[model samples]
Target: MYDLTGFQRDLLYVIAGMDDPHGLALKEKLDQYYESEIHHGRLYPNLDTLVEKGLVEKGTKDQRTNIYRITNRGQREIEARRGWENQYLDESATPT
Candidate 1:
Protein backbone atom coordinates (compact mmCIF):
# COMPACT_ATOMS: atom_id res chain seq x y z
CA MET A 1 0.00 0.00 0.00
CA TYR A 2 2.80 2.43 0.85
CA ASP A 3 4.38 1.59 -2.48
CA LEU A 4 1.29 2.82 -4.34
CA THR A 5 1.32 6.21 -6.00
CA GLY A 6 -1.23 8.74 -4.77
CA PHE A 7 -3.28 8.25 -7.92
CA GLN A 8 -3.26 4.51 -7.41
CA ARG A 9 -4.31 4.89 -3.78
CA ASP A 10 -7.17 7.13 -4.83
CA LEU A 11 -8.12 4.53 -7.40
CA LEU A 12 -8.16 1.84 -4.72
CA TYR A 13 -10.43 3.88 -2.47
CA VAL A 14 -12.82 4.58 -5.32
CA ILE A 15 -12.87 0.92 -6.29
CA ALA A 16 -13.66 -0.07 -2.71
CA GLY A 17 -16.44 2.46 -2.44
CA MET A 18 -18.32 1.42 -5.57
CA ASP A 19 -20.61 -1.50 -6.18
CA ASP A 20 -19.97 -3.58 -9.28
CA PRO A 21 -17.41 -1.01 -10.37
CA HIS A 22 -16.25 -0.90 -13.96
CA GLY A 23 -13.63 1.12 -15.80
CA LEU A 24 -15.87 3.93 -17.07
CA ALA A 25 -17.79 4.22 -13.83
CA LEU A 26 -14.58 4.52 -11.85
CA LYS A 27 -13.35 7.10 -14.37
CA GLU A 28 -16.53 9.12 -13.97
CA LYS A 29 -16.16 9.32 -10.19
CA LEU A 30 -12.52 10.33 -10.47
CA ASP A 31 -13.20 12.85 -13.23
CA GLN A 32 -15.81 14.56 -11.08
CA TYR A 33 -13.46 14.59 -8.11
CA TYR A 34 -10.56 15.93 -10.17
CA GLU A 35 -12.77 18.41 -12.05
CA SER A 36 -11.07 17.21 -15.22
CA GLU A 37 -10.81 14.25 -17.51
CA ILE A 38 -9.20 10.95 -16.59
CA HIS A 39 -7.85 9.40 -19.75
CA HIS A 40 -7.92 5.68 -20.48
CA GLY A 41 -4.20 5.44 -20.90
CA ARG A 42 -3.75 6.72 -17.39
CA LEU A 43 -6.64 4.83 -15.84
CA TYR A 44 -6.25 1.30 -17.21
CA PRO A 45 -2.59 0.85 -16.55
CA ASN A 46 -2.90 1.96 -12.95
CA LEU A 47 -5.83 -0.39 -12.51
CA ASP A 48 -3.63 -3.08 -13.99
CA THR A 49 -0.97 -2.19 -11.46
CA LEU A 50 -3.43 -2.64 -8.60
CA VAL A 51 -4.37 -5.97 -10.15
CA GLU A 52 -0.75 -6.95 -10.39
CA LYS A 53 -0.23 -6.01 -6.76
CA GLY A 54 -3.05 -8.35 -5.65
CA LEU A 55 -5.00 -5.49 -4.14
CA VAL A 56 -7.72 -5.53 -6.76
CA GLU A 57 -9.37 -8.23 -8.81
CA LYS A 58 -10.64 -7.65 -12.34
CA GLY A 59 -13.36 -9.54 -14.11
CA THR A 60 -15.39 -9.30 -17.31
CA LYS A 61 -18.65 -7.43 -17.04
CA ASP A 62 -19.22 -7.65 -20.75
CA GLN A 63 -17.19 -7.95 -23.90
CA ARG A 64 -15.96 -4.40 -23.64
CA THR A 65 -16.20 -3.56 -19.95
CA ASN A 66 -14.16 -4.79 -17.02
CA ILE A 67 -15.36 -4.92 -13.41
CA TYR A 68 -13.03 -4.26 -10.48
CA ARG A 69 -13.39 -5.27 -6.86
CA ILE A 70 -11.07 -4.93 -3.91
CA THR A 71 -9.60 -8.07 -2.49
CA ASN A 72 -9.59 -8.98 1.23
CA ARG A 73 -5.97 -7.91 1.25
CA GLY A 74 -7.03 -4.60 -0.23
CA GLN A 75 -9.64 -4.04 2.49
CA ARG A 76 -7.07 -4.87 5.15
CA GLU A 77 -4.64 -2.43 3.63
CA ILE A 78 -7.29 0.31 3.73
CA GLU A 79 -8.01 -0.44 7.37
CA ALA A 80 -4.34 -0.35 8.19
CA ARG A 81 -3.95 2.95 6.38
CA ARG A 82 -6.87 4.45 8.26
CA GLY A 83 -5.39 3.33 11.56
CA TRP A 84 -2.06 4.88 10.67
CA GLU A 85 -3.80 8.12 9.77
CA ASN A 86 -5.79 8.14 13.00
CA GLN A 87 -2.61 8.08 15.03
CA TYR A 88 -1.80 11.61 13.85
CA LEU A 89 -5.28 13.05 13.33
CA ASP A 90 -7.89 13.91 15.88
CA GLU A 91 -11.64 14.34 15.25
CA SER A 92 -11.20 18.11 15.17
CA ALA A 93 -8.60 17.91 12.46
CA THR A 94 -10.19 16.93 9.21
CA PRO A 95 -8.01 15.23 6.67
CA THR A 96 -7.59 17.10 3.46
Candidate 2:
Protein backbone atom coordinates (compact mmCIF):
# COMPACT_ATOMS: atom_id res chain seq x y z
CA MET A 1 0.00 0.00 0.00
CA TYR A 2 1.11 3.51 -0.67
CA ASP A 3 1.59 6.18 1.98
CA LEU A 4 -1.60 8.19 2.28
CA THR A 5 -2.04 11.58 3.89
CA GLY A 6 -3.95 11.73 7.16
CA PHE A 7 -6.80 13.51 5.42
CA GLN A 8 -6.95 10.85 2.73
CA ARG A 9 -7.04 8.11 5.33
CA ASP A 10 -9.78 9.91 7.19
CA LEU A 11 -11.76 10.21 3.99
CA LEU A 12 -11.37 6.51 3.33
CA TYR A 13 -12.51 5.60 6.85
CA VAL A 14 -15.52 7.87 6.51
CA ILE A 15 -16.44 6.46 3.11
CA ALA A 16 -15.98 2.90 4.32
CA GLY A 17 -18.32 3.58 7.22
CA MET A 18 -21.18 4.67 5.04
CA ASP A 19 -23.04 3.42 1.99
CA ASP A 20 -23.22 5.81 -0.93
CA PRO A 21 -21.79 8.68 1.08
CA HIS A 22 -22.14 12.02 -0.62
CA GLY A 23 -19.72 14.91 -0.42
CA LEU A 24 -21.92 16.94 1.90
CA ALA A 25 -22.38 14.02 4.26
CA LEU A 26 -18.67 13.47 4.37
CA LYS A 27 -18.09 17.14 5.08
CA GLU A 28 -20.56 17.03 7.91
CA LYS A 29 -19.04 13.90 9.40
CA LEU A 30 -15.58 15.39 9.22
CA ASP A 31 -16.73 18.65 10.68
CA GLN A 32 -18.20 16.78 13.61
CA TYR A 33 -14.95 14.95 14.18
CA TYR A 34 -12.81 18.00 13.66
CA GLU A 35 -15.16 20.41 15.47
CA SER A 36 -14.65 22.92 12.67
CA GLU A 37 -15.98 23.58 9.23
CA ILE A 38 -14.34 21.75 6.35
CA HIS A 39 -14.15 23.85 3.24
CA HIS A 40 -14.96 22.33 -0.16
CA GLY A 41 -11.61 23.46 -1.46
CA ARG A 42 -9.90 20.91 0.76
CA LEU A 43 -12.44 18.10 0.56
CA TYR A 44 -13.12 17.47 -3.14
CA PRO A 45 -9.53 17.36 -4.28
CA ASN A 46 -8.54 14.83 -1.64
CA LEU A 47 -11.52 12.75 -2.74
CA ASP A 48 -10.33 12.98 -6.32
CA THR A 49 -6.91 11.83 -5.20
CA LEU A 50 -8.46 8.74 -3.62
CA VAL A 51 -10.27 8.10 -6.88
CA GLU A 52 -7.05 8.42 -8.82
CA LYS A 53 -5.38 5.99 -6.43
CA GLY A 54 -8.14 3.37 -7.00
CA LEU A 55 -9.08 3.55 -3.34
CA VAL A 56 -12.44 5.17 -3.91
CA GLU A 57 -15.14 5.16 -6.57
CA LYS A 58 -17.25 8.19 -7.26
CA GLY A 59 -20.71 8.18 -8.75
CA THR A 60 -23.44 10.71 -9.31
CA LYS A 61 -25.81 10.96 -6.40
CA ASP A 62 -27.90 13.61 -8.12
CA GLN A 63 -27.43 16.50 -10.46
CA ARG A 64 -25.19 18.32 -8.01
CA THR A 65 -23.81 15.76 -5.61
CA ASN A 66 -21.25 13.01 -5.95
CA ILE A 67 -21.39 9.85 -3.85
CA TYR A 68 -18.29 7.94 -2.80
CA ARG A 69 -17.63 4.33 -1.86
CA ILE A 70 -14.46 2.49 -0.86
CA THR A 71 -13.15 -0.16 -3.23
CA ASN A 72 -11.76 -3.59 -2.32
CA ARG A 73 -8.25 -2.25 -2.45
CA GLY A 74 -9.21 0.48 -0.03
CA GLN A 75 -10.69 -2.05 2.35
CA ARG A 76 -7.54 -4.10 2.26
CA GLU A 77 -5.47 -1.04 2.94
CA ILE A 78 -7.60 -0.11 5.92
CA GLU A 79 -7.34 -3.65 7.25
CA ALA A 80 -3.60 -3.53 6.93
CA ARG A 81 -3.46 -0.26 8.80
CA ARG A 82 -5.66 -1.71 11.49
CA GLY A 83 -3.37 -4.71 11.77
CA TRP A 84 -0.38 -2.43 12.13
CA GLU A 85 -2.14 -0.47 14.82
CA ASN A 86 -3.00 -3.68 16.67
CA GLN A 87 0.62 -4.70 16.66
CA TYR A 88 1.59 -1.45 18.31
CA LEU A 89 -1.20 -1.74 20.82
CA ASP A 90 -0.21 -5.27 21.66
CA GLU A 91 3.37 -4.24 22.14
CA SER A 92 2.36 -1.43 24.43
CA ALA A 93 0.20 -3.78 26.46
CA THR A 94 3.00 -6.20 27.14
CA PRO A 95 4.50 -5.98 30.63
CA THR A 96 8.12 -4.94 30.75
Predicted model with the maximum TM-score: 2
Q: Which residues of candidate 2, in runs, are more than 4 Å off?
A: none
Instruction: Kindly report which residue pairs in candidate 2 clash with one another.
Output: none
TM-score of each: 0.92, 0.94
Error of model 2, residue 59, in angstroms: 0.5
Stretches > 4 Å off in candidate 1: 91-96
- For residues 1-96, could you state the per-residue lDDT of candidate 2 as single tens digits? 457889889989999999999999999999999899999999999999999999999999789988999999999999999998999999999999
Q: lDDT by residue for model 1 over 6-90, one digit each (tens)? A: 9999999999999879999999999999999999999999999999999999999889889999999999999999998897777
What do the candidate models score in CA lDDT, each in turn?
Answer: 0.95, 0.93
